[model samples]
Target: MCGIVGAVAQRNIVSILVEGLRRLEYRGYDSCGVAVLADGMPKRARSVARVADLDAQVHETKLDGATGIAHTRWATHGAPVTDNAHPIFSRDTVALVHNGIIENYESLREMLRGKGYEFVSQTDTEVVTHLIHSLYAGDLFAAVREAVKQLHGAFAIAVLHKDQPHTVVGARQGSPLVVGLGDGENFLASDALALAGSTERFIFLEEGDVCELSLDGVKITGRDGQAAEREVRNVVAYGGAVELGPYRHFMQKEIFEQPRAISDTIPATEAFDPSIFGEGAGAVFGEIDSLLILACGTSYYSGLTAKYWLESIAKIPTQVEIASEYRYRDSVPNPKSLVVVISQSGETADTLAALKHAQDLGHRHTLSVCNVGTSAMVRLTGLSFLTRAGREIGVASTKAFTTQLVALFVLAATLGKQRGHLDAAQEANYIKQLRHLPAALNSVLALEPQIIAWSEEFSRKENALFLGRGMHYPIALEGALKLKEISYIHAEAYPAGELKHGPLALVTEAMPVVTVAPNDALLEKLKSNIQEVRARGGELYVFADADTKIVNDEGLHVIRMPEHYGLLSPILHVVPLQLLAYHTACARGTDVDKPRNLAKSVTVE
Candidate 1:
């Protein structure tokens, strides 16, 4: 995934483009470039550095123009070098910036080469710039429209032509693209975060929609080449959400925001109701006999945790699958199964594709648990539960994962009530537990000082292990994921019962084992698993409930949780692990927010 911003305005657009790239830097930050049409020619600046360095270059050279397009790239087809950066030019007449992959670029490159066009960089986007230049006949809009018809994969592109000054053309196929409205200017960006203070109104383009932006107005065309009207809604940008207030990293800030986020996600309700999902959710819930959860990355772990809740509390059979793998394998599709998709951005490409695949297989009862309300997953699903987590900017998710768990717990309780598995009194008890989550989260966050000391030890190690049982196994997996994501450490998680079978062979005095020990039904079995590791001389670091009676001794380190939350311990236990990862990354002097080889959003398959 890459970030793109384009502007056609009455004033110089250099500052606006630079600021937009800074806000959109979370999408990609491998290399950045900007192209502006000035003095009847295209002036360009490129950098194989961060956005701040590129901004400095732009200002030092006094790059100015009324029309321009900028890009921050996460390289897919080529190395993260200056030549492979976006704002690629063609015949010195046109420049373009692109987001998704062009699957048919090889054939297009050969065709363009036969037409006497020489390629300079190793990128799929260069072929698009050449193709657009080849089709230009004094009309940039018509050229973009005709050129997109030859593409074979996902793409969101913004183009600027020297001949068409004060104009910018953009198109989208499978990636996200939005048009921003202003008084005497218009903007195009892959995300609305780029246009935060510039415009509050945005038009989210549909699949295969091409848009033209000018100082006068905007024009959009549908896939059939006919004029189309998409609603322009007022979107509140993440002005204060992106700021790093008093925390050293966004991950730290997000870890502390969990209490507020959980409180916002679970409504101030006295009783359980399916209507919290959306209108007609009760009908959908009544029609389903099973659930199939599709998700990727951290969202997948949250789904794994929800399966335990759905089966135990709701008395429903549930299956969880990795979204990227679900579409490639064939399975018996049950029409009565409710397909649930979970995502932080709600624009995850693999999850969206899996949702469509499920719909094609006659699974009509669909739902989404997501953070963004204006995302494609929300629009495509019949019902949705919006996680009020605000904007999550950390590459490794913290608040979004916990909020998803809260939303899914609400779903499980609602289904339990619908199936008669829970009576009125039981339902009220579940509500009481959900209401106390905010205070419980605050309690977990207070253990950061203890975890910071543990992080110092972890920073000196090259590998680690995580252990849990029952529903907490998924939380262990998430903890391992967070550690590996930011700290550059190799970590693995195993169900405590499964450790003796194979993983116990790796246990040694040099290895650190982190365990999640809640006082649940599996605690006794987990204690034996802990003895298995300790007997092998592996140092143990345990996060246990105060009532578990687990104490620290020689070779055993324990940090007591404030209380043990039955069936809801995963949400509280995950907060300390996030803190461990963040502080460990800080101790190692790594980039805690933007990890290498990873972007915040996965917009391409």
Candidate 2:
């Protein structure tokens, strides 16, 4: 995924374009660039640095215009360098920025090259710019529409022209695009966050919609080439949601926000309501004989953890599948199955496709645990639990992962009660645990100093191994994912019992073995597994609960959590791993929030 922002306003929009790019930096930040129609011609500046660097370059070049477009490229086509940056120009007439992949760019580029249109960059977007410029007959919007008609694959593009000084055009086929309404000004971006300061009212463009923006007004065209019905709605963003007031990175701030996020996602459990999933959750649970969880990335690990809860607590046969593979594979779908999809953004492409796949296979009941209530997943699913982890800006998820786990646990408890596995007293006890979760999370956060000390040593290691059992095994997977994703380290997680099979051969004095040691039934077996690591001269980092006997010793490090609730320990154990990853990436001088070649949302397949 990449971010694109365009503005056609009365005053100079250089500052607005820069600010919009900054807000959308979460989508993509490998490289950034801006193009504006200055005086009578389009002026462009691009860099492989952060948005701040691009803003400085624009000021240095004195690039200003009433109509402008900006982009942050995630670089799927070429290297993340200035040459591969967006806002690529076609002659002196057209400038363009794009957000999605063009599957047929090679043929388009060859066709344009034969037409004598010189190419400057190795990007699919450059192909679009050249194609649109080749078709230009004095009308920018019409040229863009004509060019898009010959394209294949998903894209959301914003175009600015030197000739059309007061106009900006945007078209979307698959990726997200929205138009912001202002007084005598109009804005467009791939996300609503980019328009936070400009307008409260927005038009969320439908699939295959194109819009022409100018200071006068906006004209939207549907895929059928007819005037489209536009509905404007006021979106309420959380107060101070995107600010990083006192944190080192957005990832660090989100790690600390877990306490509030977990509390808000589950709320007070005194009432012990089954409507936690939705108003119709009880009926859905009553009819389903099995559960299938479809998710991707960190959300997939949450689904993996939920498999243990659903089987042990609810006593239901459960299966977890990666959404992308599930969509392509021919899997037998049970008619009485409740298919659950988990995503933080609620716009994950593969997960949405998998949900449709299950629906098409005659599985009628669908549910989603999502953060954004306005997301397509929530709209398509029959039931949803909206996690209140507002505006997760970090690409490697922190609060959203834990919040999904919280919501899933609630769903598990509701299912258990529905199936006569949990009595009223047992459900109330679980509710009590849920109510006390926030304070427990606060206590667990106090272990950050100890985790930081571990991270100092962890930064020196090139490789790490995480081990756990049962539900905590998925937490181990998420832990290793967070470390390798942002820290640029090679890490892997395995089931503790599987250590003797193959992974033990790779352990050495240079390797640090991280273990998630919750005091569950497998603690003794996991202790034996830890001894196997220490016996091989591998340093150990153990995250254990308060009641466990794990103590710090030579080659063994233990950080005790406040208290552990059975079936809920995975949520607490994951917090320290997130902090460890964030601090280790910081110590190693790596980009913690925008890691190389990674974007926040995967809105494309």
Candidate 3:
């Protein structure tokens, strides 16, 4: 998942491009570069370092221009070195930056090489630059148009011609690209956050759309080779500046923001409405007898948690699919099943493609639980509930995960009411529980000091195991993910029942076993599983409800939760695990926010 920022303005835009890259840093990148059309030539500085380092190079070289393109590259086709950094030039005429994969680059590279074009970098993106340069006959737009026709795979590209100053051409195919509107200027970026501070008006380009940005105006051409009309909507930007405030890291700050995030996602009012999803969502809910949830990464875990909520509370048969594998395998499709896709960015490539695949199979009932209202997933789905988690800067999601659970719980309650499983009084009690969530989350945050103490031991461990029974099993998986993502520890999760089967073989005194113990129906079975772990001399760190009766003893660590939140215990139990991962990563001296070999948004397959 790379980032692209381009601007054509009357004033010098080098600083603007660099600042835009800074905003998109949360998306994750290993290399960065800026190419500007200075003095009628393409001049660029590349770095396999942070954006700040690239900015320093730009300033040291005095690389300023009125029109430019910038990129933050997350290596996919090549090593994240200066040679493979984006803004790859061809014949010194075209400077191009691309996000996403190009599948047929091998053949194209060979063809271009036979035609006397030299490839300096090992990248699929370089093929496009050569193709554009080969097709260039003074019109950069037409060259880009023709070049894209012969290309395969998903990409968002921004190109600038050395001969064509005060203009930048951008195209998107199966990837996100937006145009920012400004007086006497126009902009292009892989995400709106890049242009947040510069402009308030944006045009989210459609798939296969090509945009031409000039000093005074912007033109859009659809895949049909005709001018297309796209809505220019006003949007208020958030998280344009990545301010940590009093927190040490973005991950820590986001963990503390969960209280406000959940409150914003669901209203405290006692009334429940299905129409919050969309205008026709009530009718859609009434028609569906089952649910099919699709997502990837942490969003997939959220979907798994919702499966428990939907089947128990809504009384609907539910199935959760890992989006990447769903489309590749044959599966049963029910027209009556409401297909729900969950994503924090709303632009996850696999999830979006899976939604489209579901539609192709005649599963017309679709809903999106996402954070970005303007994301393509929301636009493509029939119904949507936008989570107000703001911008999740950390690559490992915190507030987004809790807010998604809030939305899913709301959806489940609404479905339960529609199916006659819940009456007015029951719904009001659910509403009351939701009203107390923010305060409960605050109380959970209060346990951070204790969690930090637990993290000191976790930091020294090389491997760990997490366990949970029933609904909390997914929370265990999420906890394992958070630990491995940031702390670089090898961790795995198992349903407590499965521990005696295979995972028990890995347990030892050197192994740390983290258990999510809530006073639910599965408590007795979970306790039995804990005894098995303890018998194997496995160290135990349990986050138990206050009344679970689990306590600290020799070789046993227990951190009591605030209270057992009946249906909402998963939301409360996950907080300490998150803190555990954050603090452990801090202790291990690993990159907590931007972890190794990961990106915040999975824009490419």
Off by over 4 Å in 2: 238-246, 268-274, 279-283, 359-363
Best by TM-score: 3
Off by over 4 Å in 3: none
TM-score of 1: 0.98
* Candidate 1: tens digits of C-alpha lDDT, residues 1-605: 58999999999998889889888876647999999999999888999999889999998999999999999999899999998998999989999999989999999999999999999999999999999999999999999999999998889999989999988999998889999999989999988889998999999999889999999989999999999999999998875436788998888999999999999999678877888988999999999999999999999999999999999999999999999999889978999999999999988889998999999999999999999998989999999999989878789999999999999999999999999998999888888999899999998999989999999999999999999999999999999999999999999999999998999999997889999999998899999999998899999999999988889988899999999999899999999999998999999999999999999889988
Cα deviation of 453 in candidate 2 (Å)?
2.4
Which 10-residue span in candidate 1 carries the lowest summed lDDT?
236-245
Kindly report which residue pairs in candidate 2 clash with one another.
none
TM-score of each: 0.98, 0.94, 0.99
Per-residue lDDT of 1-605 in model 2, one digit per residue for the tens? 67888999978888888888888777656889888888789888998888889888888877888889999888788888787898888887788999878999999999999999887778888999999999999988899888889989888999988888899999998677889889999999887778787888889887778899989899999998889988888985432336798998999999899889988988555644567777787788889999999999999999999999989889999999999999899899898999999998877878987898899999999999999886778878889999988888889999999999989888888888888898989888888888778788888889889899989999999999999999999999999999999998999999999999999999998989999998999999999999999999989999998888999999999999888778788988999999999999999999888888788898777
Evaluated against the true structure, the overall lDDT of model 1 is: 0.93
In terms of lDDT, the poorest run of 10 residues in model 3 is 235-244
The alpha-carbon deviation from the true structure for residue 81 of candidate 1, after best TM-score superposition, in angstroms, is 1.1
Which is superior by TM-score, 1 or 3? 3
TM-score ranking of the models: 3, 1, 2
**Can you tell me which runs of candidate 1 are displaced by over 4 Å?**
none
